[model samples]
Target chain A: MIKHLAAASLLLTTACLAIGPAAAADPGFTDTEILIGDVEPLTGPPALLGVAASIGHKIAIAEANAAGGINGRKIKYVLEDDGYVTARTIQGVKKVIDVDKVFAMLGISGSGQSIAVMPVLEKSGIPTVIDVAPVKFLWEPARKNVFVVGQSYEEGIVHLVNFLADKNPGRKWGLITQDDDYGITVRDGFDTVVKAKKLNVVYSGNYKKGQQDFSSDMLQLKDAGAEVFLAGGIIGENIAMMKELEKLGIKPVTGIFWPGRIEPVLKLMGPAGDGIYAVDYVEPFAGAAGKAFLEKAKPLVSEAEFKGINRYTMTGYAAAKVLIAAIERCGKQPTWACTISELEKTKNVETGVMAPISFGPGVRFSNQKLQIMQADTATLSFKPVD
Target chain B: MQYLVQLLISGLAIGAIYGLIAMGFAVIYKSTGLVNFAQGEMTMITAYIAWTISTTVSGNVFVVAAGAILAAVLLGLIIERLVMRPMLGEPVFATVMVTIGLAVILRSAINFIWDAYPHGLDIGIGRGIVHLGSIGVRTGQIAVIVTLLLLLTAIWAFFRYSKVGVAMRAVAADDRTALLMGISATRVHALAWAASSVIAGIGGVFFALSYDLSPAMFQLGLKAFPATILGGLDAVLGSGLGGLLIGITENLAGGYLGSGMKEVAGFAMIIVVLMVRPFGIFGERDIERV
Candidate 1:
C-alpha cells in the first residue's frame, strides 16, 4: 500500500509541473488576443503626442490583425491619459499592469513620466518600448525588459549643433530652455558640442515649465548679441520663443529640438516660422514613408484622428511594429521572456514610418540617427535640408 | 540705456496685462468677499472662446473681441447665479474652496472641449516692431498698454459715478447693511462678476495677441496674484498700479540680475509689502467686532 501511495504522489507531481509553465504565461495574453498598454498625455499640452501615438498603435495593430495577426492572435491596445504628470503616470502604469494586465507597454510620453514608472515596470518584468520620450535614463544601465526606439534628445541636439557649427562657423549662440529634464538633456548635448567646438555661448536662459512669456528672455538674448539661437524647448515654448524673436525683430539662425518639427507649430507661427531649423529622427510626414503611412492610415482612422497624425504618430507606429515583430519571432505560445529575447535580436527592422531600427544584446536604443530639417512657412511643413 | 528702455517697455506691456487680470480679482473680492481662484481659468476660457469665434467667423480682431466679451459676461452671470448664489452665507473657507473646485472644473472642461494645443491670435498685430529712435517695441505690447489704461479709466469712472457701481461698493462694505438699505446685494454681486469677466475677456484677448493661446495661459492669472495682493485685494484701480510696479520690478531684476531673479523679484516685493502693510498699498484695513 505504501508503494502504491508513492507512485500516485509522483504522478500528481508531474501533472503539477506541467501546469506551472502554462500558468506562468504573461498576463493579458490569450489564444485570440494580446493586450498592450500605453500611458501618455491625452488631455494636456502634450496631448498631441499621446493622441498621435494612439492612432499609430491603432493603425499598426489593425494592419497586423488584418494580415492574420501574430500567429493568428489579434492585438488589443489600451491607452490611459497621464496628462504629462508623473504621479498620474505611475497610476496609469499600475492600472495597465495590475488591472488591465497588458502584455507590454508602448508610447510612454515625456521623460519624467516614463522615468517615474520604471520601477513598477522593472518589478513586473514587462517588455516596454519607449517611443515618444528620448531621455537616456530609459535605456542607459539598460534593463533586460526596457527598450528605447528613438534617438535621445541629447543625441538630437548634439547632431543639430554640429550641423549648425559646420554651416555657420563661429556664430554667437544663445539658448533658452525649459527648466526640466527635457531641457537639461538638450542643454547637456548643446554644452558638449559648445565645449568641443569652443563655440561662444553668449546667453543661456531657462524658463519655468508652462511659462507663457518669453519677452524678457528674448530681449536678454538680443542684448547679448547672439547670432544663432538654440531653442531647447517643447512645442509651445519653441513657438512662443519664435514669436517673441519675431516681435523683437531678432531673427537669428535658429535651431530647435524635435518638438518644433510638428505641423501645428508651423501653422501657428505663420511667416515667423520660416527659416527656423529643426532636427528630427523620423522622416517628415510629407516624406515618402509618411505619405504611404497617411494613405494606409486614412481608411482605418477617423478623419479627425488622421488629421492629428504627425511625427509622433510615426513613433507610435514604429514602436508597435517593433513589438509586433518581436511577438512574431516568439513562435507559438510566446512567453514574456521569449518576447523580450526576440526584441533583443531585432535588426534593421523596416516599418516605412521612421528610420530602420535594430536592438540586440547590450544595445537597447534601436535608432540613433537624426536629420536636419528647415520649416517652410508656405507649406506649413518641414522639409529636409540638403 | 537702450537695454534699459527695452526692458522697461516690455515690463510695462506685461504689467498692463497683469494689472487687468488683477483688477478682475479685485472686483470679485471687493463685492463678494470671496476670492475667485478660477479667475485665471476664466481668462483662459474667454480667450479660447474668442479664438474659436475668430476661427469660425473669420472676423477681424474687433468682432472676435466683442463676441468674446459677450460670452465672458454671460458665463460670469451664469456662474454667479448658478454657483455663487447657491453658496450664499456659506463659510468663507468653503466659498473659497468652491472657487478652487470651480477652477479645476473649468480648466478640465476647456481641455475636454478644445484639447491643449496652442494657437496664435492674429489681432492684426502680426509681430510688428516699432522703432522709437534706438529702442524698439512690439505693436502688440503698445496695444496691451493702451487698452489697459483705457479699461482702467472706464472701470474707475463707472465705480465713481454709475449708480450700479456705487451700489456695488456699498454691498461690498456690508452685505447685511446694503440689504437693509434696499440695495440688492445679490444683483451687485452678479454685476461685479459680469464686469470682472468683461475685463478678463479683454485682458485674455490682448494676452493671446501678445503670446499664444493655450490652456496654460491661465497661469498668467495666478502670476498676477502678487499684483492683486500688492495693490490691495479690495482696491480695483490700485491693483492696476500694483501690476505695473510688480512687472517693472521683476523685469528690471531679470534684466540686470539674471533670468532666475525675475521670478524672485515679484514674490520678494510682495513679501516686503505684506510685512510693512498687511492690508496692501491701497487695501483698507478691516475692523471686525467680536
Candidate 2:
C-alpha cells in the first residue's frame, strides 16, 4: 500500500510540474546571457548590400561583448539570410523567432524585406530595430514592438537640399526619379523643402523602375536648366543616368540619397559621378565621426572589411548600438517589456557613427538628422565638407 | 522635334537590345517547339563570361566577342545534352518545369560565381557619342542597332538559303517527316540551341555595354518576353521588330503621357494584339501551343 501511494504522489508531482508556469527568463532571456538575432539578405542579387549591413551588426555585437556586454550578461547574436526575397524574408524572420527564440532582433535589410516581415514581427511581438531602409509606414503607425533607427528617404532628401542649396549658385532644383514608391518619397521630400524654403523649382521627371534609357529625362532637365539635380534612381539607373548626362555634356550639381555613398556606386560613377553629393543619417567613411568609428571597428572586423565599410555599415552599427544601449538600461534582470520601456526612454545617446539617437513614449523613429557628403572620383570615396 | 528625335534614338537603341534577346527566344521556340525559359539567364551568364574574358584574355572587341560566342555555344550544347536530351519523351509541362529548373540552376550558378556586385565593361568600344543634327546617340546604341540589322540579314539568309538552316527548318516543320527524309531532328535541335545561344551571347555583351553589367540584368530577358509574344513566338524577325516597336511606344507614351503610361502602353499593346491574334502576330496557327 505504501509503494502504490508513493507512485500516485510521484505521478501527481509530475502532472503539477508539466502544467506549471514557464521559466522566469523571457524567451531568449537568461540571468547571465541575452540572445539576439537578425535577418538580412546574405545571398542572391542584394547580397552585396545585405552582407555589408550584416558586417555592421557583427562589429557592433563584437564590440558590445568585448566591452563586457550589457550589465554583465553576455550577448549572443544569431543571423539568418533572407536572400532579399519577400517570402524568404518572412520565412527567415519566423525561423529566427520560432527556432532561435531570440530576445530581440537587430539587423539591416532592404525596405521591401522589412515591410514583408512586419506581420511576422507583429505576431511574435519581438522587439526589432529596422536598419538601412526606413520607409515611412513602418514607423508612422507605431507598431508597439518595433523601432526604426535609420533616417527616412524624406529626411535624407531634406538634408541633401538644405546642404546643397547654400553652395549652389543656381536655385533651380530638379528631380528625376523612379515612378514607384522611391520616387514618390523623393517627390514628397522635395516638395516639402520647396514649400518650406520657397526655393525655385525647374523640372521633375519620373520614370518606371527598370526603365533603361535616360536620354529623354536628361534632355528635359537640361532644357529646364536644373543646376541642382536630385537623382532618385537606384544603382543601375543612377549609373545609366550619369552616362547619359555625360553624353549630353552636362554635369549638374547632383545629390543622391544613402545608396550613392557605397564604394561600388562611387566606382561605377567614376568621372561622370564626380562632384555628386549624397546624404546619410550615419557618418560617411570620410567624415570625422566615421574616422572615430574606424578606430572602434578596426579591431572587430578583418582589414579587408574595414576597407570596404560604407554608409550601410554605419547604419547597421548604429542600430545595434542603440539596441544594445537600451538592453543595457534594463539592468540585471532584462525582460522584453523592460527592454522596450528602456528603448522608449532612450535619448541623446551618441552612437559615434550616426547623429545622436533619441526615442520617447509612443515614438519609434529614433533618429532624423542627416549629413551631406560628396563623392570624390579621384579617391573613389565620399568626403564630408563643412 | 529635336526632343522627339532624341527620344526616338534612345528608344531604338534600347529596343534593339530587347529585339536581340527576343530573336534568340523566338529561334529556340521555333526550332525546338519548346520555349527556353532560361534564355534571360543565358544572356546574363554569357555577359558575365564576356566580362571575364574581356578582363582576363583581351579587352579588344574582336577577342572578347569571339570568346563570349564560343562560351555561349559550349554552354548551349552542354545544356542540350544534359538537361534536354534526357527529357525527350516527357510531357510538355514537364519540359517547361525542367527548363525552369535549369534557369534556377543557371541563376544560382551566376550568383555563386560572380556575386551580386556591379561590374563595368570599360572596353572603350561603346563609349563615344555621335551627333546627327541636334540628336546625340551613344556608340553603344549604334552598335546595338547595327548588330540588329546584321542579325536580321544573317537570320534571313540562314533560314532562306543555308543548307543546314533548311534542314533545321524541315525539322521544325515536321520532325517525323524530317527524320524520314534523312535530316536528323536531334542535330537540328542542338544546332538551334547553339545558334540561339550565340545570339544570347552577342546580346548579353551589348546589353552590358548599353546598360550596366550586373546579376540584376537577368531580368532584361523577362522584359524582352513581351516583345517575343507581341511578335510571333516562332517569328524570329517579327519578335526583333516587336522589341523595337515596344521600345519606341514606351518612350512616346512616357514623353507625352505623364510618364506613368510607359509601362502600361507596352503591356496594353500586347494584350490587344494577343486578343486579335492568339498564335502571336507571327506564330504559326497550325503548331501546338507548346
Candidate 3:
C-alpha cells in the first residue's frame, strides 16, 4: 500500500512540472491585462524626445483602454529609461524581458540604443515594433519577430534630395550630418541622389553626436558657396546651424531631417526656422488628419501632454495601434508568437497619421512613403509644401 | 582671408566662453588648492538658475546676469560651509572625492528639476550681424568677448591689488603659516568658492545665451578644463586667455581639417603643452627642500 501511494505522488509531481513550463511560456497575460514594455532615453541629450515618445505610447494605451481594450484585455505599458545609453538599454531590455516577463516591447529609442538591444529582444522572442529608429540596421536582414515602421532616414533623404535637386537646378548642395550610422545613411542617400542627378556636391561635414556649435561649419559652407544646404542634424543642431548661418550672414536654402519638425524646433528656431524644408512619413499634428487625431487625443491626455504631441507622438501612436491590431487579431490568447505572425501579415494598415503600414512574409519594414513639408515659423507649424 | 577672418571672430567668441568657465576653475584651484571636478556641474546648475531667473524675473541681460551671479555666490557659500568646510583637515583625496560626489548630486538634481529640456535664453544680445569691414560678426559674439575682457580686468585687479586677495594667496601657499599670520584660511576658502561661483554664474548665462541653456551646458565647463590646464591652473587670470587659445585652435583645426578635428585639437594641445611645460604655460613650479 505504501508503494502504491509513492507511485501516485511521483506521477502528480511530473504532471505539475510539465504544466508550469506551458503556463509561463506565454507569460505577462492575465484575464484582463496584457503587459507591454518600452525602452526610452527619458534622460540625456535625447531626453525630451524620449519623453515625447513615451507620451505618445501613453495616449495610445489610454485610448485603447478607453474603448474597452483589445479583446477585453487592457495594455499595461512598462517604460524603462535607458538615458540614451546602449548598455543601460541592454540591461533594461533584459530586465523587462526576464524580470517583468512582458508579452512584447513596443517603441524603442534612438538608432544606437535600439540596435544594441536587437539580439536580446530577438533571442527572448519578444514581439518588438521598431517605432522611432527606422534606420536600416534595425530592419535589414529583418528578425522574425521585429516589425519596423516609417521610412528609413536614407529613404527620406533620397526622396527629399532628389525632389529638391529637380526643383532647384544647378544648385550647389552642402550637407552636414552627424558622424554615426544614421549620418552614414544620410550620406549614402545624398551620394546616391547626387550621383544620379549629377548634382554639384560642394561641401559635406560630419559632427559628433550632441555637438551644438556650427559656426565653423557654416563658414566652410559659405566659403564653398553652397546655395542650398541640408542641415541633417537633430532639432537643437538644426536651430544652432540656422543661428550660425544667420551670424555669418550666410542665408541658404536650409533643409532639415524629419526629426527636426517638432514644436520645440519651431519654437526654438523662431524666425530662423522659416522656409526650411523637412521630410517625414507622419503628417504634422497641425494638419487636417493630424487635427482630427489631436481632437481625439485632447480628451484622452492632459493639456501639457497634448501640447507635447508632435511627429514622434504620431509615429508612436501608429506603432502602438499596429501592435494593438495584431493583438486584437490574436483574440483572447494574445501570445507573442501570435502577435508576431499577425503583424507580419498586416498590409496597408492606416492610422490616419503616418503613411499606410504594410508587412508580409520576408518583409518587415512598414511605411516607406515620405511627405515633404515646409516650416511656417510665422504660424509656428508645418505645412505641406506644394 | 575673408573666411579666416570670419573663423577668427567666431573662434574668439567661443573662446571667450571657455575662458570665463576656466576662470572659475582657476579661482577655486588658486585659493582652495583643490581641483574642483564639480566645476562643470556648478556651471550647469547655475545656467539653469539663470534660465529660471531670466524667464521669471527679467529678460534684461543685466538683471538675469545679476540674479544668476548672486544665486551662484550663495550656492558656493552653502556648499563650502556644509560640505567643503567639514573636510577642511581631511586628506586631499577624500575632499576631492567629496567634490566628485557633489558633482553627481548636483547633476542628478539638475536632471530631476529640468529633465534636460532645452530652453532658449531669449534674453540675449541680439543675433544681428555686426559687420566689421568684410567680416560679419554677430552682436552676441561681441558681447561675449567684451564680457570676458571686462571680467578678466576686474578679476586681475582684485587678485593683484586687494588685501583679501593677498591673504587668500598666502593661505593657498601655506595655510598653516597664513593662519599664524592672522589670515583666516577658512575665510579665504569660502571667499574663493564664492568668487569662483560668481565667474561660473556669468559663464553659465553667456554660454546659455550663446546657445541654449540645458543640463548639457555642463560639457562647456569640462571643455574649459583644457583651458585651465593649458593656462596655469593656479594662474586664475591667465586661464581665460588659455580658454580663448584652445577655442581658437579648435575652430582653426575644424576649419582647416574637419569637424572631427575640432574636439581633438584642444585635448591634443593640452597633451603637447603639458609634455613641455608641466606647470602649464604660466603655472608656478614649487621647489621642495631636500
Candidate 4:
C-alpha cells in the first residue's frame, strides 16, 4: 500500500510539471478578456495628440472585437492621463502595472514620459508599443519587450536635410530651434548631414520652449546672411517663427519637420506658410488610406473626435493593428511571452495607414522612410514634393 | 545701421505690449496690495475670447476687440467679487497664494475650452512691412506702439484727474481711512480689477495679432513681471516705460550677443536697477518707524 501511494504521488507531480510549461498564466488575461493599458497626455497642451491617439486605438480595438477578438478573448483597453509630465507618467505606469495588472501597453505619448516609464516596463517584461513620440533614446539600445512605431524626429530631419541639399545644393543654412530634447535631436540630424555633405551652415540659435518672440532669433539669422533656414520647432513655435520671419522680411527657404504639416499650422501661418517644406513619414488625411481611416473611424467615434484626427492618428491606428496582429499570431493560450515573440517576428505588416512595418530580434523602429512635402498656399494643404 | 534700427523698432513694439500687461499687474497690486499672478492667464483667456468673437460674431477687428474687452471687464468684476473679495483682510501671503491658485485654475479652464492649438487672429495686422527709410517696420508693430502710447496717456489722465480714480488712490493709501472718508474700498477694488482687465484684453488682442493665439502666450505675462518690478508695482505709467526699456535691452543683447541673452539681459537690468533703487525707478519709498 505504501509503494502504491508513492508511485501515485510521483505520477501527479509529473503531470503538474507538464501542465506548467504548456499552460502559462497571465495577470490580466482571463478566459473571456485580455486587458491592455495606455499612458498618455490626455489633459495638457499635447492633449490633442493623446485624444486623437485614444480615438485611433479605440477604433482599431473596437473593429477587432467586432470581427471576433483574438483567440476568443476580447480586449479591454484602459488609459491613464499623464498630462505630458514625466512624474505623472511614472505614477500612471505604476498604477497600470501594479493595480490594473494589464498584460501590455499601447499608445505611450511624449518622449520624456516614455523615458520615465522605461524602467518599470523593462522590469515587468510587458509588451509595449510606443505610437507617439518616436524619440531615438527609446529604441536605440533596443529593450526586450518594447517596439516603436513611426519615424524619429532625428531620422525625419536627416531625410529632410538630404532632400534639401539634393534640391538646393550649397545654400547657406541656419537653424532656429527650441532649447529642448526635440530641438537637439533635429539639430543633431542637421549637423550630421551638413558635415557629411559639406553644406554651408551660417548660424544656429535656440530659444526657450514656449517662447513667443522670434524677432531676435530671426534678426540674428537674417544678419548671418542665411539663405535657407531650418525651423526646429513644433506647431505654435513654427507659426510664430514664420510670422516673425515675415515681419522681419527675411524670406529664407524655410524647412520644417513633421509637426509643422498639420492643418492648424497652415491655417495659423495663412499665406505665409506658403512655399515652406516639411519632412513627413505619414500621409495627410486627404490620402486614400487616410480617408478610409476616417470613414471607418467615423462610425466608431464621435464626430468631434473624428474631426480632431491628425497625422498622429495614423500611427496610433497602425500600432493597434500591430498589437492585434501579434496577439492573433499567438494562436491559442496567448501569454506575454507569446505576444512578444510574435511581435519580434512580425514582418512587412500593412495597416493601410502608413508604410509597411517590420521588426526582428534586437531591432525596433518599424518605419524609417520619410517623404518631402511642400505647403500649397492655394489649398492650405501639404502635397508631396516631387 | 538698418539691422540695429529694425531690432530697436521690433523690441519697442514688443515692449509696448509688455508695458500694457505690466500696467495690468501694477493697477491690481497698487489697489489691493496683492500680487495677481493670474494676470498673464487673464490676457491669454481674453485673447481667446477675442478670437472667438472674431470668428463667431463679426470679422471686423474693432468690434471683436470691443466685445472681448467688455467680456473681460465682466470677468474681472465677477472674479474680484467672487474669488478675491472673500479673501479680504486675510494675510497678504495667503491672498497672494490664492491668486496663484486662481492662475492655475484659469489656465486649466482655458486649456479645457480651447484645447491647446494655435489659432490665427487675422486682425489685418502684421501682414505688410513698411520701410521707414532704411529700417523696415511691420504694420502690426506700428499699431502696437501707437495703441500703447494712446492707452497709456488715457490711463494717466484718468488716474490723475478723475474723481473715481482719486477714490481708488485713497483706498490704496489706506483702505480703512478711505472708508472713513466716504470712499467705498470694495467699489475701488472692483474698479481697479475692471480697468486692469480691459488693459490686459487690449494687450491680448495686439499680442494675438502679432503672434498666433495660444495658451502659452500667458508666459508673456511672466516676462512682463520684470518690467512691473523695474517701473514700480504701484506706478502705472512707470511700468509701461520700464517695459519698453526691458524690451529694448533684451533685443539689443540678443542681436549683439545671441538669442539666449535676451532673457538674461532683461533680468540683469532688473537686478542692477533694484540694487541701486530697491523701490524701483518710480516706486514710493516707505519710511517705517521703529
Best by DockQ: 4
* B142: Cα error in model 4, Å: 1.8
By lDDT rank, best first, the candidates go 1, 4, 3, 2
RMSD of each: 1.9, 3.8, 2.4, 2.4
iRMSD values, candidates in order? 1.7, 2.1, 1.8, 1.7
Q: Kindly list the per-residue Cα lDDT of model 4 for residues B1-290, writing each as its tens digit.
A: 88888789989989998999999999998898878999998998898998888888887877987899899999899989999999998999999898899988887786678776678787565556788985667777788889889988998888899998888888988899999999998998998899898887788888888777876778989988899999999988889888899889989988888977877899999999999989889988877879
lDDT winner: 1
Better of 1 and 4 by lDDT: 1
What is the model-wide C-alpha lDDT for candidate 3? 0.84
Model 2 error, position B94 (Å): 2.5
Worst 10 residues of 2 chain A by lDDT: A17-26
Residue A3 deviation, candidate 4, in Å? Answer: 11
Q: Which residue pairs clash within candidate 1? A: none
In candidate 3, stretches whose alpha carbon ends up further than 4 angstroms from where it belongs are: A1-22
Judge the docking of candidate 4 as incorrect, acceptable, medium or high.
medium
lDDT of 1 by residue, B38-89 (tens): 9988988898998888888865877887799899999899999999999999
Chain A TM-score, prediction 2: 0.87
Best model per TM-score: 1
RMSD of 3: 2.4
Tens digits of per-residue lDDT, candidate 1, A203-243, equal: 99977776666678888999899999998778878887887
